[model samples]
Target: GSRQGKDERTTSPSSNFLLSHLQSIIGSPSFPYSSNSPNSLSPLLFLLHSFLRICSIPTGRPIRMGNACGRGKRPAASRDTSARDNEPRVAVNENESDRERDEKPAVTPSPKASMKRSSTPPTGAMVTSRTRASTARRPSTNRSPNASRARDREKEREREKAKEREREKEEEEDDPIQKFITYALNKGVSGLRAEFEELRLKTIPTKEQCSVFHMVANAQKNRYKDVPCSDDSRVILKELSMGTDYIHGNFCGTPKNPKRFICTQGPLPTTIVDFWSMVWQEGSEFIVMLCNFNEMGKVKCAQYFPPTQKETFVAGNAVITCESVAKQKWPGEVTIRRFTLDRIDVNQKRTITHLHWESWPDRGVPPIDATIQKLLQMVCRSSKPAVVHCSAGIGRTGTTVSIQIVTELMDSGKSMETGLGPFLIKMRKQRAGSVQNDQQYVFIHRLLLERYMSEEEKENAKFVKFAKDYDSFMV
Candidate 1:
């Protein structure tokens, strides 16, 4: 009886000490050790009783802590305040009995358990406050990589569109060819040869060259793989007068209009500097571009001119500024660009006009002559040789000059039938492949024949009018 009493006293003191410790932890405001409130102490008391009973048992089995709520019970969450007071209760010993400490089964912890396991409470923050703070710090989880890339692409496209708009706006504001464009667009192709003959080409042959003292010329600057320029009329930069003493162009036209042309190839990327030097040397006022910057995936000509208005670019010793750009009424058919060329070396400035035939068929003739005629009239008024170029500098260039020469001859009271062949032959001598094919030759003859027939009809009309007046008077 004495030994039993001693055992009871020892166990009673230990139970009292555990209950006091648990109460102190619950009362502390700094640390929240359990999610359950003080009202839910029955489960904790049951755990304490089981622990004490296990301590009294003399079995050699090791003691292990077990979940009081047991497996499948609702997890303790910091935010949840509605934990049931009448939940089904299972002995905690049953949970521990299934697995030993050395052979514990792997289990995925709930969010609450994971947070508690991973983080230590920051200073002045209890577990609850820290958990809430951690949740707030996490970034939004819904955003994806593909969505991010798509947004980036959309922004890029918008930027490109904005740049395009700026370019088009510049073109619109700088265009000055409205009057010429209006006339060309209003004009249409005619099938009647006699009617069309009245539609004369507007250009005149440049004044003839008096002396042939120009510098050495070469085929190196030419674009076509197999074409060459004739040496007689080939524009040569007067011996070291400026730069590029050689260019693949010639003086074309009559003595009456000398210095009328310095025809050359469409400027190549490697020869843009040379092209500018030639222009500066010749003091050219007009630049007639017969082809586009590119065609059919091939770059027909280098964009040697300033791409934007008032943009200055240096070509060799020349500083060229695209001072203004003008779109015709038919913007798609033609574009007139004005440039200010400043020869930095000589300190000279000149305004240059660029007449771009955007709709001129590449390596082919225009469908109608009216558009060509109107553009020619505008540029041919310049006294200085107008620099004309196509991709190869021979095909379209030859055709353009041929028409101009024919117009000038007709104006001077020359017969087309007798003058056409000599003019073409002279042009060929000055530039080897002037008329590229029989088609271009035929085209020239057709134009002249139509003009001749139209002149005859005008004379006939004049005579008939006179005869009518005479007969009426007699009556």
Candidate 2:
């Protein structure tokens, strides 16, 4: 008995020292084993069981190590609170049969056994691993390659459409012709008429201010007595020995080219000789007549040139002969006549091309056609200054001249701010009255719109069609 006591005392302290070391290692934060792992405490538990069996403890009794197993002590009444309390725990089982079973090499526990053994809540590593498994099984929210490419293509198409719209807007702004057409369409005919009236009411030179000297000195030369030429721009006949040096024509054009055209009244019976004399002296090679000799039973213009081919007429010292006649090359009542003018005194001869538009009435607009454009081309092609005429010289004459000037300005790509109003006001400085009425003014806008607008735009512009139907847009 004394020897047994000695062995007990010796083993007691050794067991206490081992238990203290094991408790410290398990409680450390850097412990490699998880409390929830099946094999985590197996080796330690086996060493403790062997030591306890050698100490003479009862084989059937369980050794409870209070908080040493990483769990706090609980009440005896609450010991059976969890379902795991009824099951045999690997940590506390000390029966001889269980000890013999544990003595063999540690076998990996089945999943069911591991689950039952881990009665406590899972550790951080275990929860992290379970979360990873769940994440791998979930459906992905990311798009596939084809779907991503389709979305990118849609965005690219939208960008291209935006760029196209910007390009069209730039074209509309840069092109003056398109700008004017858009303005006219938006304003419509009535608005254009009101705008023209407003422009006419602005500051312009009066008849008394414009024709001071010509009103008295050149009264009989003017076809209409009210229509007097400005002294500054009057066409003076060189042959002063035969008669007066005055003719009722004004030099009219843009500021760049002032002598581009000589706007005049149609020749009267008495002024026909002076007309031919003025034409011969000015070196004019083209004549644009905007009226017929007889209209509505009134003599609008004199039969100035000969009617038949090769017909000759003696007008003062100039021998005028008709060279050729091409009837109606234009769409309407238009005629082209070629004439040869021979100056007997100076012995100089020059050819003349006359384009007579007979359909345009007095104080009215002409038909919308290629007539004006064709005439503009012919006048521009001539090397010498051209003469343009209608009855009274300011109505159709001013409109035609204004159209030519604006066309040249447009073709040269010059920027204009307020459209043709400023140019017309400038022309009126040289001639007393130009663009005679509001109807004639709006007609110019319509003619330009007809010239430049596309067929699709014309179809879409309902106001343009409305104006055409209500107003006399055509001849």
Best TM-score among the predictions, by candidate number? 2
Please give, for residues 151-267, the per-residue lDDT of candidate 2 as tens digits. 999999999999999999997799877766666677777776777787777735566665543546566666775555676677777766235777778888653576889998889
Candidate 1's C-alpha runs over 4 A off are: 1-219, 239-244, 329-332, 448-475
The true-versus-predicted C-alpha distance at residue 128 of model 1, in Å, is: 99
Report backbone clashes per prediction: 12, 0
Candidate number of the best lDDT: 2
Give each model a TM-score: 0.48, 0.64
In TM-score terms, candidate 1 sits at 0.48
Model 1, 337-405: lDDT tens digits are 889999888888999998887676665555534565676677788887889888888778878877777
lDDT (C-alpha, whole model) for all candidates = 0.59, 0.70
